[model samples]
Target: MLIALFQILDFLLRIVGWVIIGQVIISWLFAFNVLNASSSGVRGFAEALERITAPLYRPIRKILPDFGGIDFSPLVLLLLIQILRMLLGGLAVELTYSDA
Candidate 1:
C-alpha cells in the first residue's frame, strides 16, 4: 500500500541522516586529532564513512578554502543532509495522507 511504501522511504531517509551525522562526528574527531591515525577501528570506520559521504562532500570540498587546520566540509554536508531528510520526510508524509 501507499502507506507501507512511504514507511520504506522514510526509513531510507532516516538511514541517510544517521550516516551523514556519523560521518560528521567521525570526521570532526579525526580532523581534530582526537583519534590517532594508527587507531585501526576509527580508521576503518572513517574509510567506510568516506565512501558514503565523499560524493556529497567532494564538490564543496574542492571550493572551500583551507583554514589552517580546520575542515568545514562536514559541517556543510551535515546541513545538506538535514535538508534532504526534511524534504524527503515531508514527501513521505504526504504520500501517507494521499492514500486516504
Candidate 2:
C-alpha cells in the first residue's frame, strides 16, 4: 500500500514537471512567433496550460524577487518537485527492503 502511494505521488509529480516543461516550450514558441496566438487552437491550448500551471507557479512567483522579464518560478517548482520525489522514493525503497 505504501509503495503504491509513493508510486502515485511520483507519477503525479512527473506529470506536473512535464506540464511545466511544456508551458516553457510553448511560451518560447509563442514569443518567437512560431505559434500564432491569434489562432483559436493555439490560444485555447495556451490558456489551458496557463490554467493548469498558474496555481503552482503563483506562490513561487510571490516569493521570488522580480528579475525584469525573466521568470524563475518554473525552475524553482521543478527543483522542489524533484526533491519531494527523491525523498518519497527513498522512503519507499526503505519500506520495501525493511519488509524483507
Off by over 4 Å in 2: none
Q: For candidate 2, which ten residues in a row score worst on lDDT?
A: 41-50
**Which candidate tops TM-score?**
2
* Candidate 1 wrongly placed segments (more than 4 Å): 59-100
lDDT of 2 at 49: 97
TM-score of each: 0.66, 0.95
Q: For residue 39, what is the lDDT in candidate 2?
A: 99
Clashing pairs for predicted structure model 1, backbone only: none
Listed per model in order, the count of residue pairs whose N, CA or C atoms clash below 3 Å is 0, 0
Residue by residue across 36-66, what tens digits does model 2's lDDT show? Answer: 9899998999989999999999999999999
